[model samples]
Target: MQNVVIIGAGQGGLQAAMSLRQEGFEGAITLIGAEKGLPYQRPPLSKAYLKTGDADALSLRPASFFEKKQITLVDGTHVEAIDRAARRVMAGDRSFDYDHLILATGTRNLRPPIPGAEQALDLRTLDDALRLRNALDRPMRCAVIGGGFIGLEFAAVARALGHEVTLAEAAPRLMARAVSPETSERFLALHRDMGSDIHLGDPVCAVRADGITLKSGTEIQADLVLMAAGVVPNSELAASAGLAVDNGVVVDTRMLTEDPAISALGDCAVFPDPVTGRAVRLESVQAATDHARLIAKRLVKQVDDPYGAVPWFWSDQADCKLQIAGLAAEGDDTILRPDGAVFRFAGDRLSAVETVNDAKTHMQTRKRLAQGPVARAALEAAEFDMAQV
Candidate 1:
């Protein structure tokens, strides 16, 4: 391939460019991003960036790194359409030809159809974090929508900054989609202990100028409202180009789309789980960077190996850090350990492991799961200590 053009200069897109060079693919690499300036990390936008308000600290790489690597970065450019027939992408009047196209378009915040939803601020980008930091400058009443990682992380920081935080969740438990009920309850107590008003099973009916109203007719008066209601994949460009898109751009185990010339990665690509063979989409930095590296190897080194990297994720709330070693289905049976590590089982087979402030156990669980499915009886014999097994 002489030229590889990547869309969306976010974490995954930037990684594809870097990985291409690392794999010795000396092609014309162009990283196109809708946002201006350097590509920064999004995970910290909800964590340290809230407290420190340091924009420079969130940068993934310096401008010098891009220049030294001979990577072309086109910032503040929105991709209008993809011409599959021409093998080129049009950004307004400009068109760039590509030997291979990588769609790392990522995702955007999902704004619900609530009244005055636009009034609520977002925390998906550095610009949003900067706005949230400015809003948290004063001791304002902060009403947060959603009890997921972003909402809880923001609540912890807001409370630490001496702001009254009221977090509302439609689900019965916090992080219901990601974590087990036991782990969700644990975080609920942690947030409550930190002086946050945690409301479960209460969906925000409407977002007003001042605050939000719950479905149970309870209104939260606040000077600032944050929309942490999750995100939607950016797959419209790929869809317009006649690519199959379910929740995201549908890619195979090799991260290649139906068209051999195109591939998708990061939050915008939905591929089958290597363990389950079920369609799954991951939004972690690990998944994105790993997909980028694998794609780079296939393009540069002609490796035919499928993407089977073990999925893992982490969230920082207050002083507690919740980590998951593998991807657990929504209704997996969770077995709790004495030391507070939660093991999820799917039909007598280990699916995932959840731990709080336990890095050793987390790593061990990931290592074990990677070897293949562990029987429930074997785990019980080891007293649920993955390190021992």
Candidate 2:
């Protein structure tokens, strides 16, 4: 390929450009981003960024790295549309022609249609975090919508900073979609012990300037409201280009779209699960970087291997650092070990392992899962000892 054009200059998009060069591809590379400034890490936006307010530490690569790598970095430019027939992308008056197109368009925060929802702040981007951090300069009552990672992490930080926090979740448990009931209950207690009011199974019906009203008609007084319900994939660009889109842009095991010249990855692409063959979309940094490397190798070295990297994720809330080694379904069977490791089983096969403040177990679980599925019978024989298994 003479020219590779990647849309969305987030982690995946930037990694694609870097990986292309690392794989010895001597081609023109263009990385387009909607946000101004160098592409920064998003995971820290909810954690350390809120406390330290260090925007410089979040940069994935320095400005000199981009220039030295001979990669064209286009910031503050929103791609208007893709002319698939012409194999060119239009961004205002400028156009970029690509021998191969990589769509790394990530997701945006999902704002519920509640009245005054737009008034609430977000923690998705660096600018959003900066706004929230500035607001925390003075002690203020905070009402956080959503009990997921972002909301909980923010609540922990706010409460530690001596602000009154009230967190509301639509689900009955914290991080219900991602964690086991045991793990959810543990975090529930963790947040409550940190002095934040936790509301379960009660979503915010309306967001106001002063506070938020729960579905149960309970109004919590607050000076600040944060919307962290969830996120929606940025697949409109690919959908307009006539590509199949489900929850995200549909890609194969190779992360290739229907058109041979186009491919999608990261939160924007829904590819089949390496283990289950089920369509899944992940929004973690690991998935984005791994997918980018796989795509780069395929383009430069003609490596046709399918994407099978083991999925892993982490979240920092207060003194707890929760880590998950693999993807687990809601219906997966859970086995909580005495050491606080939660093992999830899909049928008889091991699906995932959840650990809090246990990096050793987390890494071991990822290595074991990457090797292949471990049988429940074997775990039972080993008395739930991950090392023995």
Candidate 3:
């Protein structure tokens, strides 16, 4: 276990390199990523980056940090295939041997088969965000193709810039896959109040130079179209090598894949849900960084504790900062608080908590969820403060 090679230069990949150093791994480490430059945070690409075009702030660490940490970074490289028998990864003509391989390949934006969808712009990478920011320099009519966090965040920023914004969601609600209905309703109200024309249950049939046409025959006139529909995991690399891949590269509770020398993490890895036995793939800084830490500990110090870190996420739109702690399964019942906090429960077990601009409650929820499930009666009686327990 001297050499560790990580494919992908995203947050999770970089975190694995850093965590290995922190865990006292003096072995050879190589982090290969297709993206150029250092690993940066993607959350702000839709939020703050859209508003100010601040690229430097998104960097996880300075360039000097990587050199000082002795983490070999190979940027602008694509890992075409994995030679499982040879125990080496082939990036073009170059071959890198590894004692252990980590697939932090992450995910890519899902482009649906809609007419003229090819004309829609993407905001997944730094260059994409820069292109969008330059396009938004003037007064332009903007139509976002999704109602998810990224789409809504861009719409909010575009609206703030005095642009005419029309957000289209194929689903019945905004952020349909992530937050609770109550939280979604709140965010929907906030976006609408900010003068963005939000259309729900309306799928974009086509994108024209003028605007987007919905499935209901309604046409939205806009100068620019943003595609933030969703993303699919980049698990083809592992699947090609005969590894199990569900929604993502399937891993065990310890973050190890079918092969002992191989592991997966972040939005690319489908691991067991800490709360349930169900397999889950989470695209968040929390899951990526936590999984990296767990993998590093297991490899460096042989710390074999099961991966059970509490999941959390945050979205910034307008003046509202929505934060979520824990993972709630579908069909989870949500208990709404008077202060706009939504607590999602799976039967008697507490699953997740959604808070708007409430950092105190968010932190408390994460802390409490780490201690495992709490009774419904105790939570209802203990009031809003989980710390009060």
Model 1 lDDT at residue 112: 95
Give the TM-score (vs. native) of candidate 3.
Answer: 0.98
Q: Backbone clash tally for model 3?
A: 0
lDDT of 2 at 257: 98
Cα shift from native, residue 177, model 2 (Å): 1.2
Q: Write the per-residue lDDT of candidate 3 for residues 114-201, one digit (tens) a residue.
A: 9899899998999999999999989999999999989999999999999999999999999989989999999999999999999999
lDDT of 1: 0.94
Q: Each model's TM-score, in the order given? A: 0.99, 0.99, 0.98
Candidate 3 at 53: error in angstroms? 1.4
lDDT, candidate 1, 1-389, per-residue tens: 89999999999999999999999998899999999999999999899989998888888999999999999999999999999989999998899999999999999999999999999999998889999998787799999999999999999999999999999999999999999999998999999999999899999999998889999999999999999999999999999999999999999999999999999999999998998999999989999999999999999999989999999999999899999988999999998998888999998989999999999999998888788778899989988878666
Off by over 4 Å in 3: none
lDDT-wise, the better of 2 and 3 is: 2
Off by over 4 Å in 1: none
User: Per-residue alpha-carbon lDDT of model 2 for 1-389, expressed as tens digits?
Assistant: 89999999999999999999999999999999999999999998999889999988898999999999999999999998999999999999999999999999999999999999999999899999999999999999999999999999999999989999999999999999899999999999999999999999998999987899999999999999999999999999999999999999999999999999999989999999999999999989999999999999999999999999999999999999999999999989999999899999999988999999999989988888788888999989988777778
User: What RMSD, rounded to one decimal, does every model reach?
Assistant: 0.8, 0.7, 1.0
Clashes of each: 0, 0, 0
- Tell me the whole-model lDDT of each prediction, alpha carbons only: 0.94, 0.94, 0.92
